[model samples]
Target: MKTALSLCLLTMALGGCGNIAAVKSFNTPYGSPTSGDTARLRVIADGMVRAVPGKDCVDWYSPGAGVIAVPQKGFADRNGESLGMPKGATAMQGDVVSEVLVPAGKPFTLHFLDGGRGSYNSVTNCLGMFYFVPQKGADYEVVVHGYSACGVKLQQLGAEAPVQVTKAEYCSAMANF
Candidate 1:
């Protein structure tokens, strides 16, 4: 009985060592915006694998409202490309930069450009990945920004408050060359 009591007391004491805070789940309220963050990423894979580094890469996707954006003529494209990496290093044209949605950590594909230049993101002699996360069911204009493979300025993105709630979305805005 004494051992059991001591164990219980010890356990309780350890458990109460710090302030027990409640963790909020990621189930954000519909249309309620969270911290809309951005990142830099190199195109990894695409729908069909090719002889290019960014041929079949996973891409960055922003969600909100009822529209998804990318670096196409307008928005919404199954296959896209991101010059977001070292030239001839890996990234290539025709690589889709609109597959990944709600990228946070690790590595994800994205249409990366510095300011509004048509260049790929480069980390020394290799390609890099960028991640972006916007609010759910909200209207957001995301701009993907980053430095060119040669360490030049490159990024494009925008975020707007949701006018009408919609399902999760993904897109990649084009950066000027």
Candidate 2:
């Protein structure tokens, strides 16, 4: 009986370890646009950010798209320089930015993940989703806010000032693909 109980406890602990997911790079259109019909998107985050890359969200565990690690502002490498952005991309005020190109006039979704705070016993991760339709030849920026909760803000860059884009509610049950 003692040996059976020990084996059962070990199995339960291993099951909990299977919940971790590997990070996958975004595999769609990236880098600068080749033509004049694509838009530039810069994602700013202090933690891990994963994107669905479509109008709808599928299975929560499905690896739909890419992942980016945006370290906190002023984070530097052993060489003491800030993290790099893509070629022809600019960093703002020491912010670590991940730049990508998405087809214009299409909807895109981003999932901001906050790894949470505190030690192993007290940590609680949070997730926030935001989607927006990009206009051709436009520039946009997404800022992720995280702490006890997670949220995101999208802005259309240009004009006299940046115009805020409204956050649309997303439901995975409506996934078309």
Say which candidate scores most in TM-score.
2
Winning candidate number (lDDT): 2
Candidate 2: the clashing residue pairs are 26-66
lDDT tens per residue, model 2, 1-177: 897676556545644323233212322222233454667677766565655544544223333355544453222111122223233324344344666666677566666656555443453555666666788877777767565435565767654544444443445543312
Error of 2 at 111 (Å): 0.5
Against the true structure, candidate 2 has what lDDT? 0.51
- TM-score: model 1 vs. ground truth: 0.20
TM-score of each: 0.20, 0.56
